[model samples]
Target chain A: MSSCGVLVVAGTHGNEVNAPWLLQQWQANPDLIDAAGLAVQKVIGNPEALRRRCRYVDRDLNRCFLPEQLEQGASGLEFQRAGELLRLHGPSGEQPCAVAIDLHSTTAAMGNSLVVYGRRPADLALAALVQGALGLPIYLHEADAQQTGFLVESWPCGLVIEVGPVPQGLLNAGVVEQTRLGLESCLRALYQVRQELARLPDALVVHRHLGSRDLPKAENGEPQALVHPELQGRDWQNIASTQAMFRAADGTDRCEAWVGGEIPVFVNEAAYAEKSIAFSLTRREVWPVEPNWLLALKQLLAAA
Target chain B: MSSCGVLVVAGTHGNEVNAPWLLQQWQANPDLIDAAGLAVQKVIGNPEALRRRCRYVDRDLNRCFLPEQLEQGASGLEFQRAGELLRLHGPSGEQPCAVAIDLHSTTAAMGNSLVVYGRRPADLALAALVQGALGLPIYLHEADAQQTGFLVESWPCGLVIEVGPVPQGLLNAGVVEQTRLGLESCLRALYQVRQELARLPDALVVHRHLGSRDLPKAENGEPQALVHPELQGRDWQNIASTQAMFRAADGTDRCEAWVGGEIPVFVNEAAYAEKSIAFSLTRREVWPVEPNWLLALKQLLAAA
Candidate 1:
């Protein structure tokens, strides 16, 4: 049996304090560990500005992963710090059995979501388990070659969890809770997968859709009635066509669906404007995953 | 006549020492007097890492022009420094008559080149004059909406020059002399444009092409070749078709030409990609310009 290791990457965008706060809180709670039988390597993506409730001091740590930048030592403070963490805890040349989760949050009024990227069976299985446990929608966005440069992208299996907007009202407490729950759920899901591959499918496919939000109303009048789509669990599918099905908010009319699909599986965003949804499917076999080429190019450039 | 101002942006990427070094030297020189008939502003993009001879300390300052990131103050050190410079020297609530030239250099090889990006006719004329004076090819790359975060993009008209590769040798007197000469040449070109535009043609058309250097034979005795297409220039209204043409190194087989009018302008490697060429057409006209959308978006997000 492969020895499982979990890498919990928190604060990828320095301003999202909840992820790091949660990890720190969990570290102080020994009881939480006793309940979850999993070992985790927690990494704070950017600590410099997190102390001041700022996003970052120098650059967006998320987007500066090109190889030439690294070679020139031009990376921001946060990226350099994160690179140090990767050097210390990332997979060795021997290839450890591990999974990486990069924690983030959206500026939009999005609900809790997990963006599962990469094409590894283990990763898909883990994503499905986490979705099932958290009950939050799973958004399966294809990692564009140019956009995959985070430390998690280097791993064979990885997921990025956008925990919605950070609850500013509760400050550190909210950040801590969200982070703790997320990490715990991921570990539990990974454990379940390790113990029961026979019961689970080889992969889980997810489709995502975007919607626009209703605007605020005038002072003298009540806000216009806003009706949202009712998503019935039965409407979800494991395998389906990749076309985007556009429906009226109140289900009054059916519009054309946008083009979407992959050869062996069909996954897409199911929700409309104002909100986003993802659909998932399970498959038995897929091609062997390789390191992302765009990322490799960026790394080469930075190194050059 | 609109009062034209020149913003000399230096250190866009921290590793390119020639940019900031030249700017600093010019700043201290007595010859760079306003009496020379130009309102000049020297702005440093990333001062922190530039001092260290590294590319950047936190992030690539050039890529962090997104509105939300700027609003949240989520940026690398270089980004912050650039932002500060923008705030200090950028146009106020009212539009200003100014042009910016962000300095840069290539890492691959030594070729002095100029890059002009934007859709304005006046901008095109200015670019043409500079190219003519500098004796360099003009690469006309279309401005993508996503790339709107650059400071030059923030301005209505701007130019980026790849003077040459950063010399690996120390800051010798000869290196300084070469740097001074490059800066002076650019300044002279800009001054000439401001003084001579009325006498110049209503539209300027220049033909350009790209070439690559063939590397020496490897141990296996196979010669290395760099392949790319040649670009031809024609009047925008009179061209039969804007198509790309190519000529290989061996001078044997000529590749087919591509239709070009709708394509964006780009130079693979201005100085060092062996034999790179640039082609452009310049016409005169006026345009209404606005603040960079990314910068505006940052403000909007901050207010929200």
Candidate 2:
């Protein structure tokens, strides 16, 4: 078998410091990896950014992973870093990463969520196993032109472990500890799949991603409104059409509310503020696990 | 009397968005002041940084207000901005500000507190009034060479209205609303002192600044540990000698415990992590307000 294993990536956004800190701890104590002998490789996605205690040196590293962006090979900090990461750990690389798990924390109140870029069978299987065990709400993000080039898309089987309510560049013990538990669930899923003991639940819960909306901006693009006080920190919850979503600094309702039957995600994400995305909406669903998902996961794990 | 008033400064760190957002709200609706006609000059301390959604461009704008730093303002974004602010609102400037109330927020669980540079009677009187009315804790910062050059120090009388448990660049409704109340308290104190209707409590509660300690770091200055889980959000509370103040990523305790009786402030403050200050220690005290404190406040408010 080729040198393949589960790859755990942290520091994708350098300012999200908790997971990186946990990675270091896991390094010092190999026992923390209770994955039943699965080869787990941990790496910091943006070492330079982590050193500076900021999100990125030039551009967002997570967003720099698209094929077109990588093909250009222009000299930018995150651009170069992305090429280097793929060169070392891409599917065709010498030390191939079978399944990559990108760890992230957000200012949004998204408590231990999994983000699958598309409904890829392998990605779904992994997310399903973790969600089955941990009851994590999987955010199926797809068809968003503005938000493409996610890190997990490069790997044959990968998903994002997004934890939060933790601030950037600040460590919250509960967020860190809770995130570790979620990661452990991922590892256990991987180990079980390798041993053919994997049992993903019949139904996989997902929050189907809808397009996001930016905070209302003025002529100069300065935000005229922020996420309304009422909707702030109310991520993953269903909202009525009448619910206030955006309020001007003067406390005036300046933007349209979310349509009823849609759940809000990434509400007031600190990083998304720069991207102008106040929040993304989603529709919750419980879909039966497809047989192709388990087959893909088995094939991926068998490779490792 | 000079052209004096309470200069309410926000966006001093830029990433502290709630206060600036509130300041903008207050500007649009002047009725929020409720200060009985106390002139409150609201301004974004670092407008450029606010636009970038970061802290500062060159140096920390809040730390660029020293006598020497201002004199040598050959050129830098914040350096020039500091000179400009002084030219506009300095004691000797066109719009002489009597009491400058700097607004700030932290990632730490500091709640609503007051930070006085040193024990100036004017500062104490203001703190006393607010503390008496609101029961807010005061952090008396002094004699720390490591932390010099503050925006409030530029004015003859000023204090920072530091609020928190809020993350940087993320606005929490509770934090934003509560902070506005704190600013109102400051404005009301000025108005009360001006009309000679101020009656500060007999005792003024203070957390006397002692010193700060950083998280255990590796040789290259990368932190080896974060604020321990137990002590993570216990700001302004006494820490025991045996308390685990810091723990390595792997959940290993690796830092010295606090020496008991010393209260911690700015616990895991995101901004202070760069300055190597995980948390600053303070000794809690309840001191009787001196008669001169009210007199000093009267003079400052009367001038405004």
Candidate 3:
């Protein structure tokens, strides 16, 4: 990579419409977006899926990003698309993307969050810059290895911008605006980092991954409870052991917490229901911040 | 027909989970629901669709209630299901539903609304009772003859309890509580009607249906405009002709209203995107009401 550039991917899942729509809108009016010092390569991840107005045709494209999966030449439509994405935007590309940013929307109440796969210094630094700019939470989800096959994992420096509560295949003007603001902010941060004017506060707060809780289901697989009234729409809030989670069908049994002191993320997410996951829990972890991190990280990423 | 009975239907669309879940909860604990003076029969509309967690397997079940479709013996999955629904809860069933109330949730910011299909005396009286009890908007959508195949149309006294902005196949606890409250209020109104203690005002206001505006679309059919910033979440508000409706992708052309004095309903509705509708416009109409309308209507409905 000559100096520094970024690849922004959207609609990694076909159902997410906001990010790709934002990119399309911005591209249609390029002057409308200010990307002062960045070489931006925008790609809609799965066009076919988007056209069908469904999540995916075969397998989820986001889950097709594993290194081995790309190398082994899998036969699924998403696997083939994964190879194409790898060739076009992966690190091994002729003009590799110095940084990759995936845009996503959720049916969850996770309001404009930055997701980091790991605590890699570069990723954390970039996330810190954006977080510092937006004051949004950084969800450090590193534990679920099964979910490691994310689009951003293909690049050395990458992060995911997850915004909601927008449903799949639907566009909310507010969500579209938020996505644009986020992309603009990310581009501005990139410009600042390229100009060596970016700094990290040596310490940061992150919601570290714990695990996900599943909604109560019956033996035949129907949900047996409703999300507790108290915890509904209370995403990103800390809960105690005494907090009610779900109200049983019988109304006599209310499911309360066995474990406390954990903050719930993706609470009552609509998409996760297909996967049988209710919501993921995270515990906040504060780490000492490092200074001049973005510049250093950019230099490191460029050389990679 | 029974002297006083009510049929509450949920999951008319399989994807809408909250209402069905509410019914399930009520069924599991019948005593939890307050219907002391009423005989309530709760039914989940589309079980197969609900099991698959989809809106509909064949067609929208809610749109299969046309009298001609039922008489013609339509063959689609939803059409067959419509026949089944008619036999079970429709007006000509062995044990016909006295008052049919379909519970639905939307992907729009429609806070809580009661939808009446026509201005039949009984239907209007029932709606007026519920409107008085809950103080929610009564949307009188009678113009769209094509979209008139609603489940509520299957009975003489019927209406839809529509609540939002919740996603399909997802349950929001707050929405569930709202659904329950709406149902309870409906039930209370039924009980009052049954006891001949119901009263309706001499006048009422309704948001009369006008028409729908489609989002600007590109040649390949992607939305080319955003719901104007000014009208993003301002649902149920009257817009002047000077007000912007959609902001074009090029940002130079803002689509302003050509008509004024109309109120927009389901503004920025997520589901409408798939159907090429941006938002629906309604004009409020006030009509003269008669005294002791509920009791007279109840007697009329009972003899029907």
Could you tell me the lDDT of residue A165 within candidate 2? Answer: 89
Docking class of 2: medium
Which candidate achieves the best TM-score against the true structure? 2
Per-residue CA lDDT of model 1 for B1-304, tens digit only, reads 2244567777776556555655654555546332245566776777766665445577666666555677788756756765576576655313232566787764222355565554455455555555445555554445334334666665655667755422211121223334444455555655655454322333444322222223233365322221232232122232234332332222223333444432323222222221222222332233223333223322322222
TM-score of 2: 0.92
Tens digits of lDDT, candidate 2, A1-304: 2245777899999888889888887777777657557667788999999988789999999998889868977679998998888888877765788899999999899998999998899999999999889899889998888877888889889999999888898877778877788889998888788778999899998999888988777687757677787898788887878887777644567657567679989988888877878889899999999999999989977775
Tens digit per residue, CA lDDT, model 3, A1-304: 2356688998888889888888888787887678775778889899899887678889888888888867888788889998887787777775668789899988877888888997777888888888788888888989796576888878878888989887676777777777777777787777777666777666778999888888778787778776776776667887767877887644444655557678888888777776777888888888887654555676855564
lDDT of model 3, residue A72:
83
- Top DockQ hit: 2
Tens digit of per-residue lDDT, candidate 2, span B92-180: 77777888999999888888889999989999999999898898989999989988889998888889989988888886656777788
Q: What's the i-RMS for candidate 1 in angstroms?
A: 30.6
- Model 1: docking quality category: incorrect
Prediction 3 TM-score vs. true: 0.90
Write candidate 1's Cα lDDT for A88-181 as tens digits: 6555523232567788764223345566655445555556666557765555545445344556656656777765432211122233445456
Q: For residue B82, give model 2's deviation from the true position in Å.
A: 3.4
Give candidate 2 regions above 4 Å deviation: A72-75, A239-242, A248-258, B32-35, B68-80, B238-242, B254-257
